[model samples]
Target: MKNVFSGDFTQGFPFQGNMTGNDPSGFPFQGDFSKSETQVKPQPEIFETNDFVYVKLPMPNKDNKNLKLQHTNHQLILINYPKENEQSKYMLPSPVKRKGTRARFLDDYLEIQFIRLDESNISEIDISY
Candidate 1:
C-alpha cells in the first residue's frame, strides 16, 4: 500500500477527480477554455534607420482617407481606427527630431516617420558626492 508515511510510497500519483468525470466547478469538463470571440486592437510594426524611425499600422479593407494620426515623443494614436483599437504607446529605441515628423496612408497601411537626431553632440553632466 502506497501511503504518505510509507517509505515505499512514490512521490508521483495519478490525478483524481469526481467519479462522474465532472470538473470541480460541477460542470462537465471540456478541454476548450476560450469562451468568447472579441475584437481587439491590432498592433503596428516599427522600425528604424540611420535617419528615421517608421511605424506601419495595418488596415485591411479600410479606406485610407478615414485614418487620422496623433503622436508625441513617446506615444501615438490612430483616431477612429477600427473604432476599438485607436490608441497605442511605444517606447522608442532612440531619440528623434519631432519637428519634421511625417505620416502617410497607402494601400492598407498607415505609415509614420520621425526624423532621427544626432545624439553625439549631447553632453553628459557629472555629479559629485
Candidate 2:
C-alpha cells in the first residue's frame, strides 16, 4: 500500500480536516506578506487649533508625485500611488474659510491645514414675517 497523506504538505492535508485555510496550492507564497498585491488604506490623525484644522496621514517611502488630495468644506478625499484611496469627513470644531486650504507631504506624512473663518464677520440676514 501507499501513504495517502505523504504526497505534498504545501498542498494542504489530503484529509478533510484542513485548518490552515490557505489555498490548496499551499498559501500561494513562500512566506512573505510584503510581496502581496493588496492595497491597504492609511489612517489619519486630525487636530484643531485656534485658527486652523489640521489632518496628518502616514505613508512611508511614497513619492509625493503620486499623491492626490481633494476636499470640500466638510469632506476630504485622498489617494496615493498603486491603488490606495481613502476618504473622511468631520464636523469641524468651528467654521473654516475653505478657500485657502493648504497641504504638503513631508517626513512620510501628509499634512493639511485649513484656515478658520471669523464668525463675527458673518452677517445675519433678518427675514420678513
Candidate 3:
C-alpha cells in the first residue's frame, strides 16, 4: 500500500515530500512575499521670502554633470537625477519670474532660487451681467 498524499504534487508545499527544507520553485515560504520592484522618490522643500522663492531638494549620489533643471512660473522640474531617464517635479509656493533663476548643488542637496513675481500687478476683472 502507498500513501495517497506523498507524491510529486506535495513537493513544493511546506513540510511535505522529500523534506529538503527548500522550495524548488524559488519562492519564499514566509515573510515579504512582494515580487514587484519599487522605486524611491525624493521630496523637495519649497518656500518663499519677500523677494525670492526657494526650492531645496535632497539629491544624494548625484552631480551637476548629469542633473537637469527647468521651471515655469509655478513649478520646478528635475531630470536625469536620482536615476537616468527619470524625472521629478516640485510645485513652488508662490509664482516666480522667468528670469533671474539660479541653482546650486552643495552638501548633497540642490537649491534653487527664483525671483518672486509681483502680486500687485494682478488686475481684477468686473463681471458683466
Backbone collisions counted per model: 0, 0, 0
- TM-score of each prediction: 0.58, 0.51, 0.66
Clashing pairs in 1: none
* Clashing pairs for predicted structure model 2, backbone only: none
| Candidate 2 RMSD to the real structure | 13.0
Assess candidate 1 and give its TM-score to the true structure.
0.58
Q: Give the CA lDDT, 0 to 100, for residue 53 in model 2.
A: 88
Please report how far candidate 1 places residue 128 from its true position, in Å: 2.5
Leading candidate by TM-score: 3
The 10 consecutive residues of candidate 3 with the worst lDDT sum are 16-25
| Model 1 spans > 4 angstroms off | 1-36, 61-66, 84-86
> Residue-wise lDDT of candidate 2 within 50-108, one digit each (tens)?
88988887867665465677666666666553244544444555667769998877888
Cα deviation of 105 in candidate 1 (Å)? 2.3
Q: Report the error of model 1 at residue 100, Å.
A: 1.9
Q: Which one wins by TM-score: 2 or 3?
A: 3
How do these models rank on TM-score, best leading? 3, 1, 2
> Would you list the C-alpha lDDT of every candidate in the order shown?
0.68, 0.65, 0.76
Instruction: Estimate the TM-score for candidate 3.
Output: 0.66
Count of clashing pairs, candidate 2: 0
